[model samples]
Target: MTGTAGDVIRIAKSQVGYHEGYSGGHWTNLQKYSPAVPGLEWSQNQAWCATFAAWCFQEAGMPKGSYPVTASCALGVSWWENAGRFSDYPGIGAQVFFGSGGGSHTGLVYAYDADFIYTAEGNTNSSGSAEGDGVYLKKRARRDTYVYGYGYPSYPTGIVTADPAWKNPTAPSQQEEAVALTDDDIKKIGRQVVTGANGAKSPDDPTVEWAMSSFLGLTYKTARTIAADVAAVKAKVESLSVGGVDLDALAEKVADKLAARLAE
Candidate 1:
């Protein structure tokens, strides 16, 4: 599986303040995305908005050579279109492209509504121009000039199982990291349980995929396909609804069952 949209957004959000400058730090960092151009020089003149987007995909675990590392917004759009993922409206995490100086500019879609869209863009600033000075979040109306179509990356929707070759025995389960489950988390997990019980399959449902992978140690595919696994998930959901079962105990039981299934 490829990186999640969550992974892309998290990585992009980490670089919000990056700026083009004489110091060359941002330039050198973005250069890592384009290793094929050996000994590339750092330059403020170089347009890096697209490179920044590609780098986020890379850092989010997009396989090398699967995505093109280009500085051209048009090229990025071309790739997504060729893959049949281009669309007129922007989706969350879609790559928003714009025309600039006979070329193009781009950013990641953060959110949108009927009137406007918000973005996390690099090499831009408060004014939101494509050729602005640094990385900054910007908002624009939907009908803004130069608003080219979006390039949607094919983010994985299933629980991304670790490769057996790369799985780390020491990694902690998602429940271990939470310490305490919030009402929202429990409700969300319960929804996933109901979905599985009903035998629903949504390759684009990130929340359930996350819960299945992180809390239950099951992939979306595995949880939905295996009857016993679905029954276990449904039982937990019923326990949550009835309000007497110990969540911690149920979590452990589900995890153990899921881990056994994974072994099969």
Candidate 2:
């Protein structure tokens, strides 16, 4: 399962077997519990929820640690809740920094009910049902600090769909790695493909893949894709031999496009 909120449905389903309701995208798995994959262990009880969520994202091939994780709910969503830039939840699939904002460590998001998200963390408090304290779901308590608000905006599959009154955190988050890009940030770049979009050449639009990820973190596969696309765009532009499309200028154009979108 991937770490995306989109994957939350499948991951929840895989573990719970069946769900019958949706409170604005909240899938209540039939309360069944399954161990997270081996690479990551959600086999515990009290906190395995976040671990389970981490595994989903890990499997999805997202960066191992992009903050705003479950554990950091208090800190909102950020690359490093410990480092500040706090109070932003991008979307599902992010590593939440839990505990009173700057209090505890990190965890992952698994599922959510209307007002809160269920975390799958390696709870130090308890282990699993096996040990009499198996991994379980805990709905978060919100803090206005924005630290523990919503999903991190920068997940590989994070898309900014309309925010519903339902679900915990209540909104998408804002977190980044080397660079910061927003849902709107991606759309502007897409518009720049004006001259080439309808044409086959535009399929190779430099920002397409990232746009598809909604400008969130790059997945392992997407990272390769980004690198390739960068090379290809450079090559294709260079091959055009069109004096008008300066390589640097093209980059600026793309940046401008993204900047414009971000402003919106």
- The best candidate in terms of lDDT: 1
Q: Write the per-residue lDDT of candidate 1 for residues 1-264, one digit (tens) a residue.
A: 257777887888888877655454343323333443322234225777887888777778876655546777777878877876666676777788887521478888777887788888887778887777677888888777778777666655522221123221354657788798899888776766756864667534665666555655545556677777668698767869677768778778878987787789
lDDT of 2 by residue, 1-264 (tens): 444556643453344322222355543321222343443323332333444445455455555455323422233334443443233442343444544543443444554434555554433223322111223343564332423443443445444422443243334445434567887776666555532543434645645554545535535666676567567766877776576656776778767754664455
Worst ten-residue run, lDDT, model 1?
Answer: 159-168
TM-score versus the correct structure, for each prediction:
0.52, 0.33
Candidate 1 local distance difference test against the native = 0.69
lDDT of each: 0.69, 0.44
The segments of candidate 1 whose C-alpha lies over 4 angstroms from its true place after superposition are 23-45, 100-102, 158-264
Q: Give the TM-score of candidate 2.
A: 0.33
